[model samples]
Target: MDYGPWSLVVDAGLIGGLLLVGTLIRRWVGPAQRLMLPASVIAGFLGLLLGPRALGILPFADQLGTYASVLIAVVFACLGLGEDPHARTFGRSTAAFSAYSFAMYALQVGVGMVLAYALFVPVFGTPDGFGLLLFAGWAGGFGSAAAIGSVLGDAGWAGASSLAFTSATVGMLAGIVGGIAIANWGARRGHTDRLGRFEELPATLRTGLVPPGDREPTGIATTSASSIEPLGLQVCLVAVITVAGYGASEGIGLLFPSFSAPVFVLAFLAGLLVKGLARRTPAWQYCDQRTLKSISGVSTDVLIVCGIASITPSLVADYWVPLTLLFVTALALNLAMFRWIAPALMHGAWFEKSLFTWGWATGAVATSVALLRMVDPDLDSHTLEEFGLAYLPVAPLETASVAVTPLIVLTGLGWTIAVGWTAAGLVALVLPFVLGWTRTRRRPPDDRVEAAP
Candidate 1:
């Protein structure tokens, strides 16, 4: 298990190097997008190449679990900054639509668990059936799986670490394929936005590029003002927010045995909350757009680097059965969902409808951004807004399921099976109706929400 200097690549968070290579490659090619998914794949595969069980060049692969834990927290902080909890502006049907979306997506996790348990437990003969079930959940959740897996290990569930890495890799691959498919299909159907949609015309008053006599400014004041905080201060503010979120989440995990806080979600909420509170305060006004952007990119880049370091190649070889089973199951479930359930549930509002499917299927913020960006680059602000709204309410559910899985196993094997079956059944049978309910003008009451997946 001794690691050599070659392990430095994995140790020094070399994902930046990988990204540089990717950027160079993309530059050589045309103006192709979908960089995140490809970057994720490359990083994951690179881990496999240098991993202990494979080429044995990077025996330090075991450290990836630790990196994933912190990376997840950072990811959550980014999410919080991008979202606004106070808005609660998802319109009348958001709850129902979200409920239905989870239901439909649960089959991917449930069926995969059942099938994997049947195939692997009998062959490998491990007693951690519940751990395997939790693994399936992580796979369905994708990017969060590694973080949740580490949280599981910290809670004394060792099997979860392996399960998390395997599942996360599979989920990333699935998202890439699904995103490309959806983009191609949508484009063929004349649904994708043209480049012109993103082309920004200069405003006479705002940019001075438009003719001066073209139009007169309305006497109304602009809704927002520019904040001029120093870049260093802004960096410190972001750091404080992320640390607060991580500490708060880790503290909460101590209170509940199976409750692992998804740090990314907490950080995201904390950022948004802090920003909202600072609205009237001049101090917060100092935190300007440039500051926020710099903080976000730094955090996101760190997360990606940590994520790449945490993935072990050994899992790819050692847990091939469970990993492959989960991958195939998620793909099959997503296909069924997009083809049958989504169309049935939400007939119109193509943008929201597509977003719902893509977000659930991918379960990664980066993946979701890629999906929306593929549709329209000019739509970054609007898409991020909608996604922020749709994702936050669902954040609790995602975190709860991951955090609670270990506890469910501690109770009894029957409980784990029950949860798995319930989740799978909801996706296969109950999701469509919820979608249909939300698609209508009438809002369905929360009391009518479907059973937990």
Candidate 2:
């Protein structure tokens, strides 16, 4: 029973099995297919049901919750590893997209806090920081929720991690279901020009598996036959950065016991530093973008399953009313923004652009990309292109907020922080109009390219 490191193997095997089962279920089960749920989401729900928290069928370790935090760091460390940041050119679309993205973050936090203070505190007796779960779950996804929840848990907010995870789960479900509904509604209402039948999508996409023909080679044979493999080298490089990040975080924690920075924040900075160094060396050519993406993807899938399994259902049940209120309020606000605000901000392919934003605001980047693919299969809408450019400016501010918000709340400045963030949100909301970034010209018919086969 003292499995130690071997326990990791067992847990990983269980996760793999669950992924396989989820894929099969999605492939054969009519309802799951109809809803277009990802295999990872299904696997996560299964983990929640079978793990110790729910049915107790699986012998998962209590430390599974911590896995998300660490895996998230690994995920962040791989970001922009082989990409060029300076290549992107920002224009009106990028400016508008960046503003909208930041505005969403500010509005979610502001509205969430206000509701938590005025209603949840009086009605449910929730903690002062309860409102943060909205932004942590919806905007930051499971990773941010885990990191921020860990910080809150240390600050005497009992069951914060479980509540945040629960919120994340709800957000993911809402993003997928709501996104699909919206896409369908758009198609029905003649708002979207290209809407494909869900049944027609490839099985690999539906099941989240790479088919044989589509599977790229794992690594390039950069090394001699007797030397270490290229894949091993990449893995080692990532491990080195991750370890350095962990050490830095520990050092910071030791130096500032009051406000320990999240590991993912440090890891991201380390990644950028490593990438910068690599760019100046011969090794830059050896760094494969595809392999890095695969690593990040696997980390994310594992993180999602572990995060969902780690949720403490009883904690969620206790605050169901307030949690429900938070979820409804956030969902409504996001929908309204996409319906009205997005059109005014983004010019070309406005509906497609807004749809992508809706997906990301509710879930994560992957969810948004998936929804985008559904509406614009060929990616001709240029939402992804504009988002890529906009993210360069938006990422630093977003990450800073994610890392610092918990610390501010922990210092008992929740109300002041909420007001400041709300004001910032209002500014971001109005900046597009003031700067004349709002759409003035109508979109031409050719711009809304039909979805390609």
Candidate 3:
């Protein structure tokens, strides 16, 4: 169906209604609370049920995927703005974690591509681009899916967005459900003392409600109401950064039409520049981290719902066989990384750090945080802190993968890149042992970083 500008409002209203219903169901339903499912996920499934692909009860815009694609840039802009430009101190533990993380990205990309060429393409006739769907969803979540999907789709890969979104939803499900199982396993095997049962979780956590004593403000006012709303100020700052990124992306496209970079990355670079420029200004003092996070939170939630709902079931049905094989293989390898590789190399708090990387490797950092809370509820493991230091280089590697994966794969050198990444992953895995950089300082999680998706 043809849609105009007003379609956005209609879509937003429908999403809002679904969100309300999703929240209510979570509050009343026992299983949902136990699963710790996000309201966005619930709402997205509802949308899928009611949307055109299924029941067609509620009308939605044709550009649901586009909404998700654009919102990701907004999310990244907040991330870029939150960067701490100061030099960081890294220790062996941090180095070990970094190496582990590097391996995660490399192997996921490498093995995925290797499987695509060696197994799927020969047997199922899947395209060369099939390899990218794994990391796009598993490692980066919906944001990475949107970023990578757009690139592949533009490169003439039909239905890439739907496949990417499906991969992400499935990956997230694995992360949450599988994570809970793994956490429980850890608890049973004497890895942690905090977890008794998911049922025994505090009501506030299960119900997503904050009691009066535990209530904390989302953010403090960064600007006076008289001058401008604090949130408005933040929105304005992010908007400027976004516009700057758009300009950069557009200029780059004009100069080199063959190369199209995602606006999110450019916006992220713009955010870093903005953050650095503002560092010395008096206005910088008023830039609260929490405020930016609140903005990011809103956009991230909306995109998750839109991304899932936008998936085309038919596209998924067509690719189910290969996707199933691919995901199963990836999960088995992930288990090895979690249960074996991480423990052997990591020093103090090996279980905690490995668990953190396991969660992140399968999904994103939020998943890592949830698992960590169950294992090291007291935040003593310093896994997050160490990851933060390691993030300095880790973040770039991930970003580069998303941007360059398609370029390399499209050039018909998919297998070569696969071998190279595999070798890189293997080398990273071995370096920790050879260099003896397994020990690390157990520091506190840094507030300067925002693990926003």
Compare candidates 1 and 3 on TM-score and give the better one: 3
> Model 2: per-residue lDDT, tens digit, 7-100?
9888989889988888888888878866666777788899999998888998887778878878888887887364756756667777888888
Candidate 1 lDDT over 1-453, as tens digits, reads 455555646565455565565444433433223333344445445555655545766545455546556655655555555533565755434544555455644444455446635655566654344334333333345445655566556657675655665566556656766666666665665544432221222232112223556764422221243543356565566778889888878798889756666565577678778877887687554555544655555544444544544554554467766556656666676667665554435423444345435654655655665556556654643545554565564556555555455445444563354466556557535643544444443223211112222
Pairs that clash in candidate 3: 93-439, 93-440
What would the TM-scores of all predictions be? 0.64, 0.89, 0.90
Residue-by-residue lDDT tens digits, candidate 3, 22-115: 8887788888777677788899899988998889998988787788768888988998999464558877777888888889888988899999
Off by over 4 Å in 2: 1-3, 80-84, 202-204, 211-213, 217-221, 257-259, 441-453
Query: CA RMSD for every model?
Result: 9.2, 3.6, 5.4
Question: Which 10 consecutive positions of candidate 2 have the poorest summed lDDT?
Answer: 444-453
Indicate the residue-level lDDT of 118 in model 2: 86
What number of clashing residue pairs does each candidate have, in the order they appear?
Answer: 10, 0, 2
* Native-referenced Cα lDDT, model 1: 0.53
Q: How many Å off is the CA of 416 in candidate 2?
A: 4.3
Model 1 bad stretches (over 4 Å): 1-10, 29-41, 47-65, 77-83, 86-97, 105-142, 156-159, 182-229, 237-297, 349-352, 365-392, 410-453
Model 3 lDDT on a 0 to 1 scale: 0.80
